[model samples]
Target: MESTKDYRQLPNSSDHYCFGCSPLNPSGLQMNFFADQNTVISNVTIPDHLCGWSNIAHGGVLTTILDEIMSWAALHFIKRITMTRSMNIEFIKPVYIRNPLKAEGKVLEITGKHDAVMEGILYNDKGVACAKSTARFAIFSPKVAKRFGIADDNSLNFFANVFGIK
Candidate 1:
């Protein structure tokens, strides 16, 4: 388990988030990720209420976990805030709702300005690969940040803290 100091303690992104990554929304997944050296890892225990069919975890939920991890990994390595431009995922096996899952992501390659390719994997309690994902992210610039109505200084500071950037 990570201490609060080791985690990214920051405000939520927006008010309405059906996506699993946002922490502000009560119904969201509220998944938190931390940087471990060069990789980002998160442990999640699926709740019975979030199961899709029977006792299996929902596919959509699995995708969200992969997406979030990949995006965070990119931000950590690139030292910039970014948004996913494209993502592809493959579900290898069914994830059980009662079991704990571990997700990890790393930067594969950094393309020109604000562009990066990241890869991530999800493993079951037994360490089996349950799912995998790859994503392309575009880093947000000051101009883009203002256009999106996102707080530039606060958001950049959040990533800087995670990446240990000055």
Candidate 2:
């Protein structure tokens, strides 16, 4: 297991205006995750502004959280940066905007050289599974990483620092 201190620390790039995990995005989810053994766990509070129906969180918003958590699980646990190739989600119950949600993800399997299968679940404050997702991720290459503005050396170091690889 990686050091707990390293797992708990957010990468410097985590603040890079990301809609899901950026702390600087006021309109973003600002989600924070913790490494749990080989998985990643996070709690998300749905705001009223993110609702699709009266007092209920939007399905799209929930999907984004699941995607983010699953991607992070792949990167942190599988030791690779990746982009989602496809994701399938299942909505089991309505997510209330007034309650916090628990999101957890783990790497299910590696299917190919650059592809992985990952799974995630979202649970309401009452611990009921409200949603779940599975996704395929394609490993990021230098070219694709550069196109996303994520290939900077400083950014790589930031990730390494957070993951305790250095």
Candidate 3:
């Protein structure tokens, strides 16, 4: 099947250290996120080390990809820092190592100034849906951002760039 529409890759700060999207994480996924309007997307291949069964990708890893993409959707389109408050994932099929996979995330709704609902999906090489997820997030206001060390102007600017806040 055809792939997702071509999208622009988002930016990350020099000090960014996220396990999923950080280029600096030597052993992490180092996934790159791109945007399709309100959605965030990532295409990647699962490595052996991230697998569960002999050649099957771990559920945790798959879940992480979902969370990362959805969180990015919120951060980018919603322009807020959010944490997953609750989530449900259904694994439809086993994802094998070395298979090209795609993850997609979209903000379903903004429940409140500090709350949002989001959805995500995982597609295997042939574009069959292998997993699906939905989640609730708690967006951090400026006050909460301070407790997380993201209150500084520089840090906010960095996040704004990462999320494409114009």
Candidate 4:
């Protein structure tokens, strides 16, 4: 698939040490993402140290990838801060370490103003789906998130700027 041209690269803050997308976390996945009309996507290769059995990528790490991608999808498309309320994952095939993979997330539906249903899928280099996830997220505006103290000032400001919140 095409990695650019049609897709816009999403930004990440240097202030937070997120295990999924942070640049400052030495042991983190350091994944980056791009956005198109319908979805947010990430391409990455699992490191050997993150393997569960032999060269197979761990289920939990894969879950983290799905969660992160889905969260970003909610943030980008819904223009809200999100927290995972529930999720279900299916392991369709094995994902090997050191092999390139793609993870994608998109909003399936928005329930009311506060909740969204998201879907995340992980694919191998050959484009075979290795795993899938569906999740419910509790979305919050930047102002509400800041008031609730769930997100710090740096993140709230970044979201506010990115989403053009007044």
Candidate 5:
């Protein structure tokens, strides 16, 4: 069964302007995600402006999407702020512009107290894997993220509310 619980974006007061998941950025991807058990999924359609060659989605944009989803996966499952330490992507087929696509992410393993490995896959409208990614993420607690200047107070508050952190 599919999960109906959607991940909420940071409030405007957080000044969130991520190119991948921020809803307030006019030129951003504005992707939204939901959780299915331990997996995070986003359904998106690449706009014409992000195309690379003719109708194909840009490789950089595809990479960003994969990174974003995997980051979210690590955040949601590991309950921490996540940064991509390293990543690898494999493009199996072209993702065409102006077409429905699905991106899915899941935590493959938590290697240590603060490190995780996650995988993301982008699927075309036909449910074929168009791109695949595996990433190592560095995870930090909310307080650690705030102390390290990775996230401001408002952003940390938003995450605390959503993830039930104190």
Candidate 6:
């Protein structure tokens, strides 16, 4: 039975402990991403406790947000499991805490077998582009997924539903 879900999100797991995008992690960011065609988007509000300085969002957190959006983009948009290959980020402006931030990612190209290039950008509450990033990823094949122990029935089912693959 193919359960075709109308909406798409990065697949979740029971024990996912990712600080950037895990709903199960109590002290984590708990980011939720949505797909609009090939673009992956997430809205986040940086908390005061996550600041590096007096009121600025931590640079590591900002980079994590960028990495997450782009990684999720590769997952749902490419319909494949992947690992980030490399990332380059540029911070254009300081991000303040407790502000609505928008993170967006898109698939730039599929370079080779199970490999792709992706780009991401972060915008502040004032609609200013505060940061930008680009990266490459290694999408996994079935054999690789099995070897990595991430290819479970639940994940496959979730992917199938989101992608309408009967």
Using all chains and alpha carbons, the TM-scores for the candidates as numbered come to: 0.79, 0.86, 0.89, 0.95, 0.90, 0.85
Of 4 and 6, the candidate ahead on TM-score is 4
| Per-residue accuracy of model 6 over 1-166 as CA lDDT, tens digit each | 1112533555465556789887887767788877767688888888777899999999999999999999888877787877788999999999998888989889999998778999999998777899999999988864567678866666666656665322
Per-residue lDDT, model 2, residue 23, is: 87
Off-target runs (Cα >4 Å) in candidate 2 are 1-14, 141-144, 147-150, 164-166
Best by TM-score: 4
Q: Which stretches of model 1 miss by more than 4 angstroms? A: 1-24, 150-153, 161-166
Regions of model 5 farther than 4 Å from truth:
1-14
Better of 3 and 5 by TM-score: 5
The candidate that wins on lDDT is: 4
Candidate 2 lDDT score at position 135: 96
| 2 versus 6: better TM-score goes to | 2
Task: Decide which is better by TM-score, 4 or 5.
Answer: 4
The per-residue C-alpha lDDT of model 5 at residue 53 equals 90
* Candidate 1: residue pairs that collide: none
Query: Compared with the true structure, what per-residue lDDT tens digits does model 1 show for residues 1-60?
Result: 224355553233554464666667666667767775678777777778789999999998
lDDT per residue (tens digit) for residues 78-98 in model 5: 878889999999999988989
Each model's lDDT: 0.76, 0.81, 0.83, 0.90, 0.84, 0.81
Find the number of clashing residue pairs for candidate 5: 0
lDDT for model 4: 0.90
- The weakest ten consecutive residues by lDDT in model 6 span 1-10
